[model samples]
Target: MSNRVLMKGNEIIGEAAIRAGCKLFFGYPITPSTEIIEYLAKNLPKAGGTVLQAEDEIGAINMCYGAACTGTRVMTASSSPGISLKQEGISYCAAAELPVVLVNVNRTGPGLGGLGPTQSDYFQSTKGGGHGDYRLIVLAPSKAQELYDFTLEAFDLAEKYRNPVLILTDGFLGQMMEPVELKEKPTSPEVDKSWVVDGARGREKRIIASYSLTNEIGEANNLRWEAKFNGIKEKEQRWEEFYADDAEYLLVSYGTTGRISKSVVLNARKKGIKLGLIRPITLWPFPEKAFIPYKNKIKGIVTVELNTGQMIEDVKLAMDCCVPIYLYRRQGGMLPTETEILEFLEKQFKLSTEEV
Candidate 1:
């Protein structure tokens, strides 16, 4: 039976990972994301799991790499700057096709900006954050419930695709509390250890490095990685569409911004504004196909984000700029409030009516 409990987003994610059969977690304490590490440190061992707090983000991610190499479910959590330090390890995990789940509670950054929510890492995440030809299956959760649900789903997706999965969140979501229904715990799947070198018992030596110096070998490796990424795009583009029917304008957003946008859409509906939302759950393997059908029907899209305008670029690309794409954003620590969004929508309606 599912049980409901009020919890913070970071704690929910950590607990959900454990319920998803994740046996190992290694991470460094970072602002707005430290709750995840604290949760795991307190409860993982009681659940027959292991949790390690490394000296730094690099060490934490490498610890995850070692655990994942043994075909065990492993994870790490951090904010933007810490995530930056772990990029090299994330790339290696991707190249090695290891199933590791990473939670990035995004914060403003270029370097150690602050402990405030920011989606500035959109390009870094979707465009391959580290040096290599690979992609991470990135999931963006807007609510505490989604944080729980997506954390479990992330593990499944990571294992299914044999690639790293990233849960991209922001400080607002991490700090907020909400009721979440804990789902049934998943049973651990038997992993094939033929490729893993736990101790190299009676098998050829195993190498998991991404350094193939030969041009031919490197090209072949790239091709293989491309195939895997393509496969993911084909099978794993997840999104949520709300109040789309009879709507002339659509709002596109993710993470905490999406939650606020949902409220805006609801408020606009009361004023008879025809608007809807397309919330991308999987940021990577982006739901490009989802927007194709609505391209001609919708008047335009308003891209809402916490950063200045990162994901807006992706929305424009997905819609092919067929309709006018407007951006509504907040930066640093502040979130785009529902009142601000509704005001923006009212202005859009007036402007569009005048244009017509």
Candidate 2:
């Protein structure tokens, strides 16, 4: 029988990680994403895994770094503020080429933002959360099923690339409930300790350092990292598109906002609005090809974001302003409801009647 079950988004993330062969979870409790840690705390032990609640987000991510150095499948999750605290560790993870998974159930940012859904961290996550020439393999999930699937995918991508993979979500997606079918549990691959410091048996001590003193050596390392990122872009870009057959307008969004935008598109379709949606599953890669076909047909594009405006910039760059791209966003922890989006579309379409 399929392991299909109704679960909260956060719970599904933790459970799916276990099924994906994640054995170590280190995190501190935070709003929206705290359930992930709670779930792992109870279930990881039952699964013969380990879960540690560190003193703070910094400590939590550092613990993750330590566990990852031993070739353990490690993960850490937090909301916006906590994620900010973990940026230093994230940068270190990137520079050291450590395979790790990070989940950010984002809320409003730039300070002690409210514990409400917001996609304000788009730039922070996609452009690398900390200082350094690096990129996180960022995945954005619009539904609970995508959350579960992407958690598993994140583990594999992290190991395959030897880089950190971030599941960038929002508070709404994290707190929502939905039915999800857990994929078959992945077999844990035997750890290759050739590079890891696993007890240092019959091998020289391994160093997992991010710093290179020489400028030339650091530049060489950075170039190697860029080549890896290019490889990832060639192999890992992912996106979903719909209704471009004769669409005049395309909506670009991700995570919870993307799901809501899709609902708006469907509802507008019944009302004869020829609109389409491009959901970028991998936010960092930006799914540059997802909009190429619609470039000619797209008279205008609407970008719906939970933040004031972030991913819209990427959409604009991708489209090169060939089409009139409009931004519809709500910030300060407010969600853009379907009616609000439809109303915006009505204004854009210049509908004379109230049919919209």
Off by over 4 Å in 1: 187-192, 349-356
lDDT of 2 by residue, 1-356 (tens): 78889999999999999888789999999897999999999999888899989999999999989988888899999999999999999999999889999999998878988878899999999998798879999999999899998998788888888899999998788888899998785664554446777776776777889887999998999999999999998888899887756887888888888888888888778888888889899998889888788777778988999887889889988898898888999987888888899889779867544555
Count of backbone clashes, every candidate in sequence: 0, 0
Return the TM-score for candidate 2, rounded to 2 decimals. Answer: 0.95
lDDT of each: 0.87, 0.88
Question: Which whole-number lDDT from 0 to 100 does residue 245 have in model 2?
Answer: 66
TM-score of each: 0.95, 0.95
Using lDDT as the measure, the top candidate is 2
Which residue pairs overlap in candidate 1's backbone?
Answer: none
Model 1: residue 331 alpha-carbon error in angstroms: 0.6
